[model samples]
Target: MIKHRFSAFLLSALLLSTGVMAAQPDNVIRPVRGTIDSVKGNAVTITTRQGEKLEVALTNNTKVNSVSEAKISDIKPDSFIGTAAVQQADGSLKALEVHVFDPSLRGSGEGFNPFESADGNVNTMTNGTVGKLVNSHGRTMTVKVKDQQKTVIVPDDVPVVLIAPGSRNLLQPGTKVVLHGAKDDKGQWVVRGISAGKDGLTPPM
Candidate 1:
């Protein structure tokens, strides 16, 4: 049993781990079971019969439907819900999942957001000095990151949400970041997300 001062939901699977006496950062593999105590903007507050309360965060990925595919209503204070709760480092009950008739809030690992779910591995990545974008071809460009002019294959899956220097989104000989959409002949590198410093169009060599 993870020794928690409060009676929040804890994962049964991980409470009994050996060698580790402290509760895992997140071992609640399954969702917590409880009743909806309150409903907030993307998050819902649920309270179990034992007076344990938890707040669950929901995104597009959360499964909020029920087995019958019917939406839950009322969400009575005493209704039963299978829930998974975690005591966050900040000492808050984090609802892993909530089961209700409507089930419009099943935890999809941690809820869902389209922009966030689009690419899990993609983050705001930056290369040193940020190379200048030089138009090598139509709608295609190339530039050396930082200082090295080493030939690096641009990836297509990247999402260049923003470009450095300005919002022109134009790829020119002096453009710091080569933000163009073109695939390599071998079809391996695809330049999608690249950022340049906030200084100017051309990066310092």
Candidate 2:
């Protein structure tokens, strides 16, 4: 009996050390602080506030908040950022998610996008980046994180029925907005959500 109890105790300790606790979050979601030093295919060369310029991972849960769009013109040819983020790395951000908002979406009667998957109904995910919505035509409505006017395309397998429409048309031009999505292998974005705020939107740098 003593040996059996010792073995059980040891197993419990091992599980605890391995982080198998039921209380652990499914995945950690938080905001990170940094700037996009450069944008490549699907990745951004971020210069962290700590003065370290490293290539961080852009995940689906990543949310970029700024007064400016993420275009080359929106940022200075040579700019730095004081990135405020919640990440699980000791170095650059390898984003697992992103989130976006349209500052222009006030009182626009925004629409929503819808898609069906064999798995089941889709719901809001903490890991998604762009606004998954649709236009009045029942067409998927996606905008580039770098340029809201730039419509995004989606793969047939990827559902895009989350974002509410009027993101581009309803919101006033130059409306304050935030875009959410993560970089892909080609450095483009997979948006998950969007929003517009009365404040926190600034023009391009």
Candidate 3:
């Protein structure tokens, strides 16, 4: 009986050391928005809009994309896009900004969720395909995400931009960036994708 108890205790210790008995960390991809403070080798330090500093690691497989200004005419039927909007008093969505995604990024973030803006305002982000366009009270359109649909109005003063493939050279200090990444086992932020502003344009989306 003594020998059997020793064997059971040894097995439990081995499992604990290998993390088999430990709770797994959350690996869900979350957005991090900040301005680059410095770039050294494979790591980038940033100061978040909330004034917290964080260091994010970049792997060779990390994707870097850039956003540039686009016109409202760029949006059409069948376009895949994402927009940040606020709910109006009448139950409609008024667009704060519109971002047209590259074809390769179709269906990215494909749903509605609450978005916290840099200035602390709460908005909604809708990513989907354009179903129809109507020039009613404004540039109103129907956006469909899977089976659900949302009606959004793009006002004349709202910023619209296009997101496309970019190079890592865009990750310069002092530039604004938004990245989606997950924490690794070592508690390091591993970037899956990052979007940087181009030509002094802030990535509004």
Task: Compute each candidate's TM-score over C-alphas.
Answer: 0.22, 0.23, 0.79
Write model 1 residue lDDT over 1-205, tens digit each, in one string.
4566333444445454421222334422211233454545554454522345544444443322212211222222322222222333553222322232223322222221111011121111112221232322211212222343221222232222221122222322232331212233553223232223233322110
Q: What overall lDDT, based on C-alpha atoms, would model 1 receive against the true structure?
A: 0.28
Instruction: Select the stronger candidate by TM-score from 2 and 3.
Output: 3
C-alpha lDDT of candidate 2 relative to the true structure: 0.31
Backbone clashes, candidate 3: 0
User: Candidate 3 local accuracy as lDDT?
Assistant: 0.82
How well does candidate 1 score on lDDT at residue 133?
29
Candidate 3 TM-score over all chains jointly: 0.79
Single out the weakest 10-residue window by summed lDDT for candidate 1: 112-121
- How would you order the candidates by TM-score, starting with the best? 3, 2, 1
Candidate 2's TM-score: 0.23
lDDT against the true structure, each candidate: 0.28, 0.31, 0.82
Report the lDDT tens digits of candidate 2 across residue range 32-127.
223445555445454433445545444545443223233212212112211112222442221112223233332222222221111222221221
